[model samples]
Target chain A: MISNEFYSQENHGPYELYSLGDFELEDGGEIPDCKLAYNTFGELNKAKDNAIIIPTWFSGTSKDYEAYIGEDRALNPNKYFIIIINQIGNGLSSSPHNSPDLMSMSDFPNVRIGDDVRAQHQLITDKYGIKEIALVVGGSMGAQQTFEWAVRYPDMVKRAAPIAGTAKNTQHDFLFTETLIEAITSDPGWKSGNYQSNTEIAEGLKRHANIWAVMGLSTEFYKQEKWELFGVDTLDEFITGFLQPFFQMMDPNALLTMAWKWQRGDVSRNTNGNLEEALGRIKAKMFIMPIDEDMFFPPRDCEAEQKMIPGSELKVVHSIAGHFGLFGGEGSYYHDQIDKHLNELLAIPVPDKVI
Target chain B: MISNEFYSQENHGPYELYSLGDFELEDGGEIPDCKLAYNTFGELNKAKDNAIIIPTWFSGTSKDYEAYIGEDRALNPNKYFIIIINQIGNGLSSSPHNSPDLMSMSDFPNVRIGDDVRAQHQLITDKYGIKEIALVVGGSMGAQQTFEWAVRYPDMVKRAAPIAGTAKNTQHDFLFTETLIEAITSDPGWKSGNYQSNTEIAEGLKRHANIWAVMGLSTEFYKQEKWELFGVDTLDEFITGFLQPFFQMMDPNALLTMAWKWQRGDVSRNTNGNLEEALGRIKAKMFIMPIDEDMFFPPRDCEAEQKMIPGSELKVVHSIAGHFGLFGGEGSYYHDQIDKHLNELLAIPVPDKVI
Candidate 1:
């Protein structure tokens, strides 16, 4: 939803671009000298507890969720400090699109949610000297990172709002993610993840969008013929005509990387072979809300985890907007829910504030 | 699950190998000739009103749901005649696997839910000489067809049980269907659907199963490390380890064709442009139920459709099995709900049968 006008700018306020530094991926594989491009917003409070972490979704950049980080919104720059951490696949960060020494397809580390959270932890703790986060808020894959933060480092963050995210992967989601990655790597343009000049990953990217878009909206929207609003007469037209542009503009490698991470998503993996045990590890107070109509993180799946966590709050966003209901739809409807929940969490007085 | 001994039998009861004389598809495209490999059970009563229809799911043959159509089940031989129609692409029906002249990928005619229902109608009237069905039951893509029957040939069916299905295609679903097709088509072995040998298609089929196995199970299944139940550790091992053999037993062209049909699923496509208006055309009563943990058809989607359809009954099948819970699970606790509804429907006063 970021504007094209914003993308036209040279940089996003004093930001430092990173290279592929020596680091390990979530799958126990190592990618030496991985790169990362990122940006920061708001002044860091004295103790840094006021900092908010925003991780990007699939094909999202540090700039993707920039709209929510300015002076007015939830993570207002005027109050809490904000860090826009670019995910691995995002071109701005170390990605297949700009890597000087691109890894082979087989060598492209199979990253999990832990890898993403761990990397962001490195960025904040190593570089910014920030120790505690007031909150980690995100949507879709980003929300996955937010969840990982609570589980991977329970004491690192005070609260987490995981919206439109699943506690673990489903079979259908695995297939969808696999197909999307296969679409890219197997494409004639892919060249074994090393395509030559004059290749278009549009077919692969279009395929990704087709799958990912379903997770964004609800079945109710489809029944109502919302494709008309998007200006496509048929689903094929939506895939080939309307969606190709976005895909064509994306880096195929980054798409593959992000999809791989999404497919490998699981907090239980971090817990070492126990799902219920992993749920118990989340010491941070959690707000796990998934849209009731969401195909990706169906409320029933979320409810399973809700039942596991002793006192965790589980709210179902009742909207035809599906997964996107967390951000879109009536501002009153979404903001009220978000505000109510955030205020309640904020009211729980911390024994000591880092800020 | 059908027993291996049943599949081994050379004699498949009531299943005739019938080929269609030169026929055109719903899109006005000619198939030159087509074949329908189907099975029938029970007997058509004197009134012809005691007829039941069970349409096949995606990649499913006439034999897939055979256990459901028996003397003791809801579709008992003692009560009604049962016909298990195998949709096109199920190998028993016309597909690139057996067709002398194969349809190219670009030329593959778009087949909708209407097309499946219409073709099954022809089977009933032209082959069996039967007029009406007591019930049309199907799950997943099959469920899409069941609803199609209610909308397309409203007078022909008295009731429909569409499980884990929706009135229209959701974006999430479209992506899954499209990506699966793409996964097969993108394979270097695929050769753009013009492979001289079916080896690549076999690879595509294997990949297709990999996707299916993931989508069918709950994340909890994976989180619990139940791949051991399926006898595997990692997903890749699970994919290459087991699904390859299961998928190898099927025809590749049939898989692609079914995937194509699933993407084009729309009841409204036959009734008119409006989906709700199409629902209004349904003369047959509907019992729409989705698995409580089904990722593809979340319960909220079912609730929304139930609200739209007057007098339609919506029930949630509580099981951890996800999409497959409709036909799977331990004892199927939801079977009681289904049995109760069917018993009530059968007791209702009947009017003159419609031709």
Candidate 2:
């Protein structure tokens, strides 16, 4: 029920789950016919030159980020065709919750950011015959995938915008993700990742969400609006009120899968441990914006990348809202700041020469 | 081996555990006479009027915070008496690891911030024979106990310095702590908290510490220092360098017990359901400092308390180190800030109205 209502309102477009074959995930587990949940908006021009790719954030679905793919937005459907791809392990995609055989927790592959992009690449090229993408833009985990897209296929994307994202996973980032994964796998019902038709683990899911929210907003933002943001007058009220909706929407298995990928996310890992070499391999017009208060991918993380990637532009969104400010918040000020840079890039003449 | 060497340093100072009656922990489980291991650096003055109480931080022994109490520091022994009370679950105190009877994970009583102070009260009053404290201070979990001292025994403390701490548990905090407990409990070795005297569950302990460190520092700190901090270049190096030590140094039962108390640390829960009412009970002059960059106890958490406690002074230290900055890093800014206020308090002539 609550999920059905959520789905109806959130997912308004036609979609499909494309099986990409039994690929070995990083965890060395084989997920047969691994499928991805995808949604598309806007008509693709005959040439397919205006196609853009959008990826999901942590515990986010193709539907949540689909709002950005509509008319008048950055990927304005009026001019471009947008494809929202759900990374594997999310509920809509082939995940632990619905997998026929129920993948073993230990055997699950160590999925990296690049793996998601690679899977999406297979879906796009084989199914749609799209040869190029107009842009690849996203925030949080989505932003991570966007960076992977550029690195994996240097010549495929015209430009890339990675907001509130990281080039590679940090220990802190890895730890948080590991914590969430452990929460689900450790549940009595988990049964080593084989639970089916069990009661929702509200306590487990709620605990996971609480940690997630800490990184979403800054201390300043929480101070100013913990009551309004969490929708409660007292701390208990705030916690319970916040968890009620969060638990309703989140799937523990899906959260684990996304967390697994996030923990293992490293484009450099794909290139034999050479991070700078891997980043240097990217050819897309790179624009990296890190939310100043973001606990996951703080501005300094972006700064490190900016210095390493030749010609990469770095814009620090100074706001109290943490990782979530990449969306809008009291830190909306930084949102506008990002838009200015994006507008500048959008206005730049499609270069006279491809070189 | 690394942990043994690290903890064996002269700074650790006379490592030992003291029995504090077999108490029931947060969970209905029971452990016979829990031992609390603590070390003191500064001498207790003659009048004992110059005494300062320093509580241990989460996962820390008295040694972890001892660095701040020596000569030249704010808590210099030459001028003050300092008592460092290790919390119940911190291995040095009684924990699941070294108990005589096999302890069930659920058997531990969820010792709250208040319980920590209450236990310390016994140590000081019964063992040390102290009458009053000039200042009670701590950071993170230690800070939580410091706040408790003021609320539980206002007449005994003249000044309270609670840094990077909250008076109550937030849902977000609970979720994180819960997930941590789940991680340790989920380990196959855990065996429903009955895994005593066998092999320690290193994997689970490693996972718990990994998550704990992530929240303790900011994303910026991670970006700037991950490799250098751990002295490794790759992800594996980082993970191994960081988690291995925690696994070796920590007692699995202690980890679970600490997490249980942290999750249940609702200051108001002890004094009914109202946090403001509990805060209002404090008679000590309060100075609450929350680190601006601390993702765990952000400035907002402290600001919430400042608003509730009458005439409480609030200071926010801007540091990229997040929660850890309150003790080991740029925490000095806050320490200095508190010193200014302490001097002002000391400068004031003692009111003629002595009780």
Candidate 3:
């Protein structure tokens, strides 16, 4: 997992590590000296009330999220203290790729979405002595963390926005994740995640990217020749040069660690598989946003979860880019839509008391 | 490629071989001692105008399609001399696995839809002595051949019906097929398509099925838990017992041969990539039926091609099963709709002159 140019700490982002010595996982595992890599914008005031926490998604680093937070954006850093926290197993954090204690390829213990949110909770309370979060927002797996944050600590989060993800992973998504996992595992070069170099499993990693090419982006994105926007003329070049090369540069172990937890993501586990009861615990003002063209977490799936939350509003983000629209892959169409909904949500004042 | 239990002539269908005897292909390749596998129903009338051709889909044999033709169905074996021809590389025909001349796994030359239709034409004319056809209808890869049949021989065909496929393969589908190919080829056991046995590539075959689990069936199919209709209690069981097992039995070389041609399927190649011009040559009463919820070959893609044909109608089959609805995997809903369209298309009188 280590000794590779595939991932280096310096290139990850403008970040600082928040260490939780002997970090205990919610899933009965521990990450010895767990490190969370986070990059922040603006400044935390003495009151620590104007703070926003944004978690990273699958295969995402804190750096990838810089576009979402800017001075001119609705998530303006000038107004709020923005923190982009990378989740465990995302290379920059205490992942299978970097953990010295769990040096073996497959030895990294499973970290649930709940574990990620709990660690973020620890980072906030311990590092900054922050009592309130103005908002906790994220997309995809980050949305799972967002949902967990709102539910696990109902009073700490004043508002929560989860984008293009579900509280409980669907049966379809679980199998979809299975294929992604299989893509890496089936390659003999993977060698049970003990490949000498990430490049040793290059074929498997490319296979992983191939799956993403089909499911990670919307079909319409290809049908309309949207890859032309990426400056790739042919579909072959788009896949060969863009998609495959992207995953070929990542650690397979890090990917599997995230994919395993992603398949089992269930906030409903809080109330013994009762999603309604689990969502009923949320005190934050909720806006459930799903990308309209997203094949994975379609609007209907998000709407089903929205109905479970008492005052939650379902905001369908229109984009032809599907799940890839999470980071505004196209010309600011997704980010612009995201800014509008977030602005509307942020405008509402926090209630005097928690529900 | 040969001498494997994975594929046998007797197990494929009640088929007889029609030898093409060193068949020449459209793409300047030749299959030495080419054989076309076919199963016929009813008798060809004296006029030989009552004969109908139903080509097999990807990985399908003649037996798998028997359910579509019966006394009660629109494709009644009693009235129409129904011929279910197995396409080249489907194992039952002159496939990579069965070709003694092309003994190596990757040695089999690429077989196009045009070649399949060409061989079927030779069989129909040479054996049955049928000059005119009643109707040509198929789905998926078979649909590609149907379009080829109508265009390549405008006067010979009376009616055309293509289901859940395009006249020219879309850019989205081309890449989608790439993932399917990569799933098999990326496996180490595949050994560049020269595996010891199909069982050796079980992991790859299962991976191939996993891809289909996501794209081959409609999202609504999984969302609504339609696997229960297949008498499966859980998704894991359905995939493990049903989907995975179905593909595990097929030869990787055979599947790849069909898939390679499938990726390049475009009747417009005849007219220098002008789809409108290529489709404009069709004179058969065309009814382009696309499965309404199909993720791969969506109704929009099919409708786009249908508009090009002068008198063609787009009949969208309403099914949650998506492309899997091609074979009545659920109830008889898919077949019932197919019969309704085929009956109307078949009943239309063949014009005295070719358009």
Best by TM-score: 3
Relative to the real complex, the DockQ score for model 2 comes to: 0.35
Q: Model 3, residue B123: displacement in angstroms?
A: 0.8
- Top candidate, metric DockQ: 3
lDDT of candidate 3 over A76-134, digit per residue (tens): 89989999999988888888878784544688888899989888889988998888999
Q: Give the alpha-carbon lDDT of every model.
A: 0.68, 0.68, 0.86
lDDT of 2 by residue, A1-355 (tens): 0132333324433568798998765545567888888888787889777787888887777766643444544567788788898877666766665556445333444566766888899999999988877778888888889888988888787778888888787766776676666656655665654444334555556556655655566656545554553345665565566644565455565677788788777778768989899899887777788877776776777788767775778877676657766545333355457657666656554443243
Task: Please give, for residues B48-134, the per-residue lDDT of candidate 2 as tens digits.
Answer: 666778888777778767556656566777777777777876766655544454543445555666666777777777777687778
Q: What order do you get sorting by DockQ, best first? A: 3, 1, 2
Model 2 clashes, total count = 21
State the displacement of the C-alpha of residue B133, model 1, in Å, after optimal TM-score superposition. 3.5
What does the lDDT read for residue A89 in candidate 2? 65
In candidate 1, the second chain superimposes onto the true chain B with a TM-score of 0.87
**Candidate achieving higher TM-score, 1 or 2:** 1
- For model 3, residues B220-289, the per-residue Cα lDDT tens digits are 7888888875568877778898889989999999999999999989999889989899999998999999
